[model samples]
Target: MRSFFKIQFLFLILIFISARLYSQEAENEKPFEAPYLFGSDTLIELSITTNIKELIRDTGKKSKYHQARLSYQLGDSVVSMLVQLKTRGHYRKNKNVCAFPPLRIKFDKASSSYTLFHDQDKLKIVGHCRNNNSRFQQMIFQEYLIYKAYQILTPEGFSVRLARITYKDSAKEVKNLEEYVFFIEDFEKMAKRNGKIPIYKDRIHQNNTMIYEVTRMAVFQFMVGNTDWGVPTLHNIKMIAKTPTSRPVPVPYDFDWASLVNAPYAVPNEKLDIESIHERLYRGYRRTPEELEFVFKEFRMKKESFYSLYQNSDLLTEKEIKRVINYFDEFYDIINNPKLVKRYFIDNSRQVRYK
Candidate 1:
């Protein structure tokens, strides 16, 4: 009787331990909830105490986030809140074009995503700056459309919210400008939506990356005629891993300098052997025929929906639409032709990802 009782007690202890571990696992694997953030046309008003020019030109300084007040009139009520701002982007900073420098905004401790301001530790805001040039403004708008295209392709991507921001210079009355700007989905939030955690490991090989995600990314990059990204450099790319042991997936961004947008300042890398941003190059590794066939079939399925996106774009002018569509047409033409795909994407595929 003593031996039987002792065995029963051990079994009960094992059951208790198993239950505790299962509870923890269930919490971690809970279904991801997505926040339906952003409006089609949200009018935002902002007031900053810092000198707008100095704050924007503070490219080298990264010590502190400048404080500011943000307010938007909701019906009859004024929703005013405290916020912090920081300068963003590298190329635009060096180009002396004050018109389009990107920025990062953070909500005050008092503010939460549920509050009128929405929840975010920091939000990536791509500004429409640079002498208030209409062309540049058009370019910014087109880039936002690109983000939308990615979203349609996969739910596991960044979503952009358009905001017409009005800035007031605290020191200089005439230094303010009302321009079209857009903010992107926060990275932490994106990971949650995908039921995964963000992986910051850079310079990882494409082979080590998720096949579906990397192939889609590579095909999409080709469609955009962009040669600016690579797996090793982590340039214009982000990765997320489902778990520590899961293979990472690639998420690409920063389309302002890509071929399809073709901003005046955008240039192709000389090492790419292309003189124009309009040139398309296959930068992804050459996979087996079976692997590439699957990817190509995916793109073929996405072709009509992809073109439809550009056709109904909200911000692109007729001419801008034509130019972008034509560029895509070139890519589709290549992918449609077996001979061309072999010569361009497969035959021309880089054997080495780094080189």
Candidate 2:
């Protein structure tokens, strides 16, 4: 009886150790916990320290990355990480054109785990063009607002987080420079989130696109008074599809030329034959009245939410807000009037499909 009791006690001790070992192994195999950076619309503040002069001037070469230190607040702690940044854009990358060009930041994904940027790899940072120009800064914020407005319209839109950035230049006397900028969500991240894959083929016709998405994109572009995009060229737009045979869904970005931002350098496409960027044009293909009205109703339903995006913000001046609201009012008027809607959307719409 004593031997049997001793064996039972030893077996129970072994089971206890095995259970603990198994629990620890399971814990080690747990998936990474990622924090959602764009989960809210609240303003974010960030700091980036680097050689500012070299970064701004390094655009002359084909591709060069400058080491930068990025820091941001998370709860009571400030998290800092090493990042590689380089100038990104076609015209804006030119130093003569834009004093401060936009940046593409690459984060160390392995080290970024369990932080605000856990799953983040590369993110585009839209910065104010001219360093000291306040109007340009406002335009940057305006572009951010445009992204926010798009978010209100559809879940397919790219998520953006506006940030007040303080750039610390290590090489110059101007040690600190504050500016308004925003970070665009990674394209692959967004595509995966929507259970889709990004496609890179250009010259595709709009007729090959998802009708509802393409139609909404057209109306939204018209509302923003922007004609700097097209599906044929994939200019200022991205394509994503659920499957190989699925119609590509259009995702628009780069709103710096959008009338809502109205950057000083922005001009209407000469081919568009428009006097100014503010002049609205519907570049989308013609859709049935039923299809158009369905999209129109969606815009009507979300009008107030769109208005509130600018109204509730403290970034834009009273004058700026009023100007934007007035611009929106004009769009609403055009969409509401049957004659204007028919003329702009139905009658004047594109007839020839892209080859």
Candidate 3:
């Protein structure tokens, strides 16, 4: 009896060692790659400036504050852009009222630029001034405000807008600075220009002032290039100001196409299954335990939804989709283990329930 017990104990120890080794190997393996969504062909140019204390001081009281200037040249089409000043505020107070630092921005088509104003007190540009060069100060303030406002209004899709501005202090000395602008056109526009139907449009108002809160998504059959068809791509991405003035100002970071373009596209391969899983599960309004189980089980069996999710989903690219499929085919055995299922349920049950 003692001999038989010792043999059984040895067998159990070997099984434990093998399981640990397999788990470690799985952890060290490379992750699966997703498809590459082709970017727009157009290139964008951008310039930025911040920290304009002197300009601010001089124009603080003026009715019109010049923000920034935007110039774009696309295939021989050139237009000078401007943004009308709306309001401004200091950073310490009125965090909710306006973009902190008492600044509000509005688009002015007449001037073809955007405008900036101090506080949301009125629909006009205003600035403040202290000692020296009041006239030059006002001029600079106006021009800078126009330029800043323009930067705020231009959409990222028409990627060729070039911007430039200067920031000065009370002594008219240059302070902190940043300059460069990059535009990333929305995915829908790119598809449209490439002969695909656009998936999104801005909500238009009769007054011409855009109601930024609402957007309409297109639902129709559209051809996008030769590879993929019948799906909507990402849309309405705009280039937002990273730094408002010569000094750093918090501006909402929107879709940045420039960065996306520079990054290398991932190649297709079997290592992309995790991403496939994430993309498949991310869709739909609410998912339950049974639904989650169905996805995992079906995916392990070369299911269509598992592949279709990545292929039809506008969020990923063709190359990425193939990679995810490959990963699923190769690693299904490891991925579908019973232990993984139990652990996944325990950790993600609350999230699934809430969704």
Cα lDDT, all candidates: 0.77, 0.88, 0.31
lDDT (tens digit, per residue) of candidate 3 on 270-314: 432333212211111223445545544533444453445445544
lDDT of 1 by residue, 1-355 (tens): 9999999999999999999999999999986553355534344454434556666766764625777777766678766777887887777766465544678888875654444445567888887767578887887888888887787678777777887777877677456677888888888788878899988887789878997778878888888877788776789888878997799888888898787777888888878867887777878888777787788787788878888988977778899999988888888788778788888778888786354
For each of the candidates, the C-alpha root-mean-square deviation to the true structure, in angstroms, is 8.7, 3.7, 27.1
Per-prediction TM-score: 0.84, 0.89, 0.27
Candidate 1: misplaced stretches above 4 Å?
1-35, 38-50, 61-63, 95-100, 353-355
State the displacement of the C-alpha of residue 143, model 2, in Å, after optimal TM-score superposition: 0.9
TM-score of 1: 0.84
Indicate the residue-level lDDT of 348 in model 3: 30
What clash pairs does model 2 have? none
Candidate 3's C-alpha runs over 4 A off are 1-41, 48-66, 73-78, 84-105, 111-172, 175-290, 293-338, 351-355
lDDT of 2 by residue, 294-327 (tens): 9999999999999998999999988889989999
Instruction: For candidate 1, list the clashing residue pairs, or say none.
Output: 99-129, 99-130, 100-129, 100-130, 113-118, 113-119
* Error of model 3, residue 3, in angstroms: 99
Predictions ranked by TM-score, top down? 2, 1, 3
Residue-pair clash count for candidate 3: 68
